[model samples]
Target: MNVADKNLARVGSDELAANSPDTRTRHGKLVSPVITLAHGGGGKAMRDLIDDVFIEAFSNPTLNTLEDQARFQLSDLARYGDRLAMTTDSYVIDPIFFPGGDIGKLAICGTVNDLAVGGATPLYLTCAMIIEEGMQVSTLRQIVKSMADTAKAAGVFIVTGDTKVVGRSSCDKIFINTAGIGVIHQDFKLGADKAQDGDHILVNGYLGDHGAAILNARGDMHLTSPIESDCAPLHELIQTLLTAAPNTRFIRDATRGGIASVLNEIAAASKCAIEIHETKTPIRQEVKGFCEILGLDPLYLANEGKLVAVVPANESQAALSAMRDHPLGKYSADIGSVLPGGRAGRVHMQTSFGGKRIVDMLVGEQLPRIC
Candidate 1:
């Protein structure tokens, strides 16, 4: 079997230990069949759990200190920029593991994206886990390793964290909280209110994949198709857009409330009218079918990898070219524009049928338990 398949099966069988250091007994392969309250009782079990599962996977000089806080020299921070950017988020997605990623990956990317949307250079992260009593130790190990792997790939460090365990049903299998730290150059400026008249709106890639993937993974509808969560880190893509379109006004990652919600916020904040064309929105064929069958609007669906960018009309082509060149933004498109001579604080989409309708704030989440 492939390495990924083997790791996925390791939670039920121990044979994969031959090729995996994570399966070794010293790294949290405990004698107990499942985790218990004692794992969080502040004793030897807790220490062993932290040392084996977390410290082993996220080994770094800063975290290795094992102190209450992580310290950095002011000079070290100044190397990247004159200002600092910070963001915190919690992931409580049900069924921690999904088609394209898990809660661990989501936690890391979600935290990093929050900072990156503002043109920050991501650097460090803090992971806090809340685990349930009956969770499998092997499963927890897999999750922690996923977090570590994602953080390393995103050029950030999981420097410190805390852990807690509760009753069997007190929480889901696991919940992760993360805080991200990054540096912002003094020249870079972006905000929700920065959008201006005649600005063009752009998206990194296809939207609504995460929500559809999570709903299908749950098997509540007794239906299935090849839909996977579009979970990814987009700091690199944002940097590329900023380089090409230095006059870009604002950027926002489309997450829980989806692109529709983000556009509404931008319009309201900028006090302008925004218009998007349905023909220009990039969406997968599978996602289109999934939404059509469920009477759902893809515009309001959640997305983990998509982002909205507002760029000036003169620089729109340059920004789109830069985004298309990036791996994460292979499907980038200019979908809309801020209307001129209007500050209605409204967002509307020009329909494929040649009409328009107001796209307002999502009153409530269409999908719950989504990161």
Candidate 2:
């Protein structure tokens, strides 16, 4: 039988067996054999699987609710007067190791930046790893060590973790998923919708360095450039900026979908037009050449150590100065501003020659499976 047919047949057989009166415990509850994909699919099968596995393991009221998200009350003393922020990310960057940093570093930095952009001071993280069979233990050690270093640099702790192993062919060499929790200052309120017309958009640094650096590291294309990934922790840079501009509205790290996608999202969320000046947006010459030769748009490319900030015009310069003084934001610039004209929720690029064009989200996938 075909794989699909075989799976269906087994599922049918299991369902019949599960419903049979004989398939019950002494307590008279139906029993299941093991976990399956249906367990995560949120159907009758999922309910049974959860009752059999997860609830049986943890058996907590918070987890039993099975709502879209778990909510709980935190003590005001624990809050320390800061709002809570949480973020999660998975890293499966190829080669594991690459220019500037490795997948481990990316995993930690990626989630930390998410919390940072949410106006949270990242404090803790949980790491989960999936390793393929026959993978070298030494390599795993290296990745773990890198995670430790990255967390230390960002001033966060890895409070918990999990590890799983799969058949050699079932997974790549390794994959890392990290979830982070942070506390946002009481005065700092940032969200995509907080963006307003006349708000200036500032980027922490040049673009596309991470994506280009990974491509070069892969040896997929025959080109050489000193453009290493700008992968670094932004907690300090962000903290410095927050100190100067307590009234900042929103911030986001440009990662998977890059600056274009982020600006498009902010524009749509805030119902404003984002006008980015190509001339002012920094791009290393090598990156521009690489993108030109490879038919890539730097706008849609990923960045690791960069953030997009929308701040008041009065505080824009101070924020820029704070960003520039920080090592991670040394190349920072004021790239654009929120405009009321043009299509709402759209991003327009002012070309280097002084013309305008639309910048949109990545349609499918330009650089696939990058972090």
Candidate 3:
């Protein structure tokens, strides 16, 4: 078997024993072995499916009530911070299961990172799923379990959800949508328009691993490598950076379109020019080779666990130190700087070959359905 297949096989073997057929019962009802149209018909089959798969895996007081909506106490939210931050994201990645993570884990981390980059402490999330009829019950159970573990690690709760089943052709095997709510401290203020001249640009670690891993997992190119998705929660890393450099001008997660698109957006919003040094940008050798072979630019490839920070020149060292000290930011680097307003709304890169080039927004989709 190829590397991607081998990796998936290993994951299945490791988890299948615990998730066998004998373990598929809840409330004295044996859950259906496979999803059918009846599971989405809003009747006993639907309730039983929800109870056995979702509610069972994500058990908490708020979610257990089985109410139409989840309610939160304002007083409890006020303890974390004064401002609230909320974000929602959908995951429709091909090959629902991939190296290092699956669609379920991606949904949680993507939403959590969105709130984190906005200077918020993520508190809760809502999960909604659209499943294709005929998908295996065992597959749904595995994905839901992965979501539960990721939510617990991020210190957030999944308190509400909705499930819909459609004809097999209407959707892929499954799709996940997650919305997150967080609280931000009154002292923290950040936005893309806040970037200023002389602000140093920093990235937490290597980029494009998630995109590369997903592409390889599809096996379209018949290629293989040890690259795994860099899918992870960045709230702690952001919190640490904020503590060390309170004057950080802006922070953004490098997701779709990678760091290139993020820099272009920041430049346009702030009316400033961003200049990055090619030599300083960190990229895995395997990803670089893969991109080279495919005629792809790593800069435009997506990343899940990376963030770009714009901090004042004076505080750059402190921010770098704080990032490097964290487990996720050990490979952090100051890749570039926000320059004066002469070339407003532009992103330029200093190529390693001693030349400069404009890094503009992508003209079209480089990879579609890549989450």
Best by lDDT: 3
Segments of candidate 2 deviating more than 4 angstroms: 1-79
Residue 63's lDDT in candidate 1: 75
Ten-residue region with minimum lDDT total, candidate 3 = 13-22
Q: What local lDDT score does residue 180 receive in model 1, on the 0 to 100 scale?
A: 90
Predicted candidate 2, C-alpha RMSD: 13.9
* Cα shift from native, residue 313, model 2 (Å): 0.7
lDDT computed for candidate 3: 0.87
Tens digits of per-residue lDDT for model 3 on 1-371?
12342244234322322222232234724367899999989988998888888988987767776678777667666755688899999999998998989999999999999998998877779999999999999999999999999988887788889999999799999999999988787778999999999999999999999889999999988886898999999988888898789899899999889999999999999999999999999999999999999999999999999999999999999999999999999999999998875599999999999999999998888899888
Residue runs of model 3 more than 4 Å from their true location after superposition = 1-28
Worst 10 residues of 1 by lDDT: 11-20
| Clashes, model 2 | 0
Q: After the best TM-score superposition of candidate 3, give how far the Cα of residue 192 lies from its true spot, in angstroms.
A: 0.1
- Candidate 3, residue 54: the lDDT equals 90
By lDDT rank, best first, the candidates go: 3, 1, 2
The Cα RMSD of model 3 versus the native structure comes to 8.4
Q: Rank the candidates by TM-score, best first.
A: 3, 1, 2
